[model samples]
Target: MASCKFLFIYPDINEFSHAYDGNNGCYYYGIAQLSSVLKRVGVETGLLHYTLRPAKEKFLNDIDNFTPDIIGFSSTTMMIADVYEWVRWIRESGRHSPLVLGGSHATLDYKRVAADGLFDVIFIGESEESIVEYCQHYRERPTNILGTVVKGDNDYIFNPARVLEQNLDRYPFPDWTLFDYESLYDMKTHKRGILMAARGCPYRCSFCSNDRYADLYRNKGKILRIKTVDYVIREAKAMKIQYPAINYFQFVEDTVGFDRIWLKEFSERWPREVGMDFYANLNVNVCNDDTIKLLALAGCRRLQIGVETGNESRRKEILKKPVLNKTIEAVVKECHKHDIDVNSLNMIGLPFESEENILETIHFNARLKPKLLQCTIFYPFPHTSLYDYCVEHKLISESNLSRTDYFRESILENPKISQEALYFFRDNFKTLIKIYRYVNIDWLIRLVGYKRAGKIIRLFRTRSELKKWLYQPRKKLLKYV
Candidate 1:
């Protein structure tokens, strides 16, 4: 076959209103890795990183310019609406390239994606090997390929699932050159070198897709796979050398400290070789005292630990994160002792969670005294356990909910909690944290009650201009308290 042009569209949806520029400071591992694998097999690759909804003219112009044989889209559940819009444009423009859908949304909701009739083919789980075979025989109708859903006579074909790759290092380092890597680095405030040193998270957080993914490839191999310590150190060195201006490294894996032996070896070698300040995500359960010390010794200046909710019962039963409150407290305390800045991640507006529950999370953060705190409204993605719960309990319609950015608002129609209260806590979470530091916010909650407080805070949304006018004095009064 002659050389083929493969154009991949990454609907990197952040805020809907942002422009369709390529400078979105994100590197999707799936896209880059796929691109590299395709390139290795001598296929030409190009990318359209769209952050905004595209105008018809510009969207068609990009498609016409690239003139690809295969038009692949990488999508998440939240970004499916954007993908639908783009695919419609491609069809209306009379482009006959075979459309392929892949990524988290495709893997989790392959049946839905296949039934949509939007794409000619759908790739489900890890498709490195299957993708290469598909690319090699794109001109002919291919079937029975592992880890794909394809259209067939009479009905769609559900192919056998692919085994998860055991040795992650066998795959080429992601082709960052496909993306505007320099602009992504330059756009950042602190010039972070984003890298992923591992694949898979063993924990089955209810809201996360890891559990479902693990179940998909149940007997394939070990669920959690980490790169060799030497491989990671080499990749770090390569990134640092290529981008000399990188101030720090952020390992964007689920949890870099999953393997104690790998972490121990990494901790010893990283500071001596790469010698750059780094940050990583660690599961709260893994943030033991020895791990904290090792991380600090490796020049880790900060770590992000997900506390999800402060209510231990809810965390254990509802969220399926069995970490105790005592463990969380000890983790934060140990991080501080090692002079590592702790960034605590929390969520609000969960199903059946009340204003008091949100306040409990906020007060929990105050007690932990994390250097940074981030809270987002819970978004129930398709096929996750919580999503099924939301659907079955009538909190949200599984098929009818609109696309949502979790940071913006929840799609759940929960009776126990109002969106107003959720918006209030989300908008003023930091302010409430500050106020809690000075005085007891619970006193005001007690005086007015949760419902009344929620009603009062709704003014910030109802009268947008009055929000600023009222916010300053409220904070000032709290300062006096």
Candidate 2:
């Protein structure tokens, strides 16, 4: 039989607000690794990344040119609606190739995906080995594959569960050959290389998908796993050789410091061997003075830490991240001391969360004075604990659930806090932080606290002229020297 060819489709639709020239900072390592595995076995692979929705003809023409035996789609919860539309279009065009759906969405909601009958196979959890096995036996139409849910004559074939890959170094580095690295690197401001040194997060944050995904493979094996420090350094060196333009790397793990031993070894060797700065996410609950120092020694330029909410009780009870405010402050202080830039991630518009609570979050970030303050309207992703809570409270609007771009807007029908109020907070959150940071509001914050300070900022937020004057770019006048 001829070698099977696969086409990987990724819908990176960010609602088209940002530019999408096929390289807008969205890299799917799963698909890249899958392509590598296929190539190692002499199978052919192609990728059609759609940053924007394409015309039907364009989509069809690209597929026709490749003529892949299998078409696979990797999507997050945000891209599911668009994926459904594209799959339907493919079916309407009389294509007979087997369709596969994988990624976070499929792994978390395999039952729903299988019930839809849109895909011939739905891969759950890790698909690196499963995919190669599927391609090898696609002609046989076997249904007993460990990690797949395959379509049957009458119903779906639920295969036995597959275990997680504890040893990450078992597989080769991701196939960057599948992507246009030069174009991607050119579009990026930092010319950063993206790499994932680990597999999972240890904490089970309610709003995050990690907890839900972990429960899916409860008895399989250890959920959180990391590659050896030597393996990671080797990958980094190879990445530098492949793309000499890459000045630094961004390790895109949910949390990178869970294993301090692994981190210590990496920190010691990374700068000495690679000689480039890097950035990675750190859980505030896991970070300490020593961790920050180790990271700085490794040439870590910035660290992204989550400060999801300011209401301590809500953070613990609602979000399941039982970290103290003082703990967060100390972590930020250590990061600052080490000259590691901190980007604090926050969320607003949580269920049953009051305006004052949101203000507390803003005020809290201002106090920490992180180099970057990032906020997003809370989006209760499907299958997450928060999603179930929102559903139980009848706050979810099924009609408006189509869009998952929480950064743009909220879809909750929250009674305590209106969507309009949520929008107001999201729109002005950064500006409020700026006011607290630059302007003299320490007295007001100390005296009136979060609620009253929020009122004053709300008034300021309404005045566009004042905002424009405060933040407008100043022109550099030419002077003869």
Candidate 3:
């Protein structure tokens, strides 16, 4: 069999793949984008996909059958422990595949990944362009490839991130038609596909682990490389041309409405240009009556806003939410007035959050009553404002490639609250949402797909009972940072 120039393999991490209420455990749009680019440039490529729940025999069969020149795997901060296990497998496999690691996890931890010598190369951010150059010349002088780390001299080579492709118009449309996108779902997007228009968020949210995602570019500051309106229309037009049938077109931007003028242009032009409904995130503070009107005209069916908390003091002094509670209410009201569906992106754990702070959250949502709401237990993302605070306050235990969950276990660093109480409260945060409104059937169906049907059902057994239990605090020995 002729060896292919490259192979993209999404390593299998058991338990996480089947989880739908949380991490779907799948690769991002990079796979589709990179695959399309490689194929367009005439590089022979294959995807060795082994989903978390794949039959063991099939997983082994796929790996053994598709032998290629290089293997590239993607990972995240929480999943790096599982990812390291897979990297170890490749190293101990007795085969020299010249493994490479890409995506957020590898980008932030370049020093760690490179120093460990587990991966042959670590492709820095937006690796598509650099990867092509590496493949073309690997057979000649492999050591001279730019944007790659070769293990020997303890050199900290920081390859400049490929400038955001100016001629993005030239890149091949993402090959979503090649993979199964319907199986991937989260609270905001139900059984969907994604379109990445922009990357690197400027907001310094304390809990977010975004540094890894935007690592190569942060040195440049909150600078973003956005696809032009023409490019977005061009991409959307190509989506139908290529995939023919796609579930949904999501902006995948940290804040889609970041640039009001860009969205205004998209809202005015795209309905006629591409003719597709897109779901996107809206920074609550940035939105207003005009913003809602523009977005409604743009065919935005779903809008997700990060309403971290309702505590006004916490919003300003602690969380740094630019707008006040009234600002959020006005925005939510305007969204409702425009007949746009709203989803509250709520957080459970925070640096200065308290039981009273949580009630403010519950009361805030009870009043707003969004069509949908997403509840997340705070996962302290590395390289965020929160991560720094945690380190400074002796909140975070020393972390490394092996720490998957942000909190090593349930935890509270301050003397005010107990770790056990925080965990129990966090565990029942979902029920609080259910107390106000029924879970969407589509969301419930997807959750059931996780194979944890009993757990999902028992979670909402009696909101009152759960609330009473949460009210009574319990302390335990738990490490969380």
Candidate 4:
């Protein structure tokens, strides 16, 4: 038989623009890695990023051009709605290609996805090994393959779980060439390169998907695995050679500072060999003076630390993060001392959290004064501890999970606060932080609380609006001038 052709689509439900102009978007690392694995096994594969061209005309054009045997989708919870729509369109258009769904959302909610009857095969957990196996034995009948939930004649056939790859170094470097890098730039730094030095997170935050991911691979070997320092350096060197215009690299791992030994080795060799400024996400608990210093030495220009919440009691009990405010402060200060810019990732509208709790978080972050304060409304992803908590309390507003977007609004209905309050706070968090910094009336602000403070903050909302209005004209004028 001829080699089976696969077309992987990364849905573009996200509101963020991926225009082909100067403002390019980041590449999905998961699809890139899967494509690499398939290529290594001599399987022909093509990638179509819907974000690059979200129009149906372009989508159909590409589909007709490729004419693949299998059409796969790598989706998150937010992108599942778009995936369903696309699947329906494909079926209506008389495309006989089997649809496969993979990624965190599909893995966590396989039964629901399977029940929808859109996907022929749903891959749970990792798909690097499973995809190759499935393609090798591509036939009309559902073959018994591990790590896949196949739709049979009557019911679905849930296969045995697949083992996790213990040795990450064995896998080939992700096929960066698969992505149109010319139209891709890191949204954060506007850089043109992205890489994952490791896979999986060691810690289990209540709101994180890591816990469910770990449970899926319970009997399997270790969940957290890292590439060899030399392997990482080699990949970096090759990426730089391939994309000579890449200004900086970003390691999109869950936590880069988890392994001190691996970090030290990487720090020692990365600067000597790759010699490019990089950025990474770090957990506050693992960050110390030594690790911060090492990261700085390795040419890490910026570090993003998750300060999920500042309410100590709620953070410890509800969020399951045992980190103290002092530890977070120390890490931020250390990064500042080392001339590394710090970005704080925070969340609002968590379960059992009151408006006061959110104020505490705001105050804590204001005091820290990170270069960037990135905040998102809490999203209770399926299969997470937080998701269960929301379900138990009946805080979930709607059955459709795709209706929520962390950047836009909160889906949960908290009895302690109103949704309007959550939206106001999320929208104006940075403005509130700035006001708190210049004003020496913290005691007064605390006494008044977020509700009253929000009222006061609204008084200045007109000025902010006016500034935006003024800036638009100047911005447009500059484009022409």
Best by TM-score: 1
RMSD value for candidate 1: 4.4
Ordering by TM-score = 1, 2, 4, 3
TM-score of each: 0.91, 0.90, 0.79, 0.89
Report the poorest 10 consecutive residues by lDDT, candidate 2. 472-481
Alpha carbon lDDT at 127, candidate 2? 85
Instruction: Give per-residue CA lDDT, model 1, range 29-148, as digits (tens).
Output: 778889999999988999998766678899889988988999999888888888898899889878899999999999888988888888888998888898788989988879778889
Expressed as tens digits, the lDDT of each residue in 1-481 for candidate 2 is 4489999998878643354444554666778888888888878999998777789899999999999999999988778888998899999999999999998889877898888889999998888878989999998887889999999889999996788889899888889878776665232555878889998888898999897877877898998899998888899899889888888889899987888888788888988888899999988777755888888999998999889998999999999999999999999999889899999999998888987898789889989999998888888877889889999999887566664687898888777776656776776688777675455444444544445455556656544533453353333111100
Model 1 off-target regions past 4 Å?
Answer: 15-25, 185-187, 442-481
Error of 1 at 424 (Å): 0.4
Better of 1 and 3 by TM-score: 1
Q: How well does model 4 score by local distance difference test?
A: 0.81
lDDT of each: 0.81, 0.82, 0.64, 0.81
Quick one: best lDDT, which candidate? 2
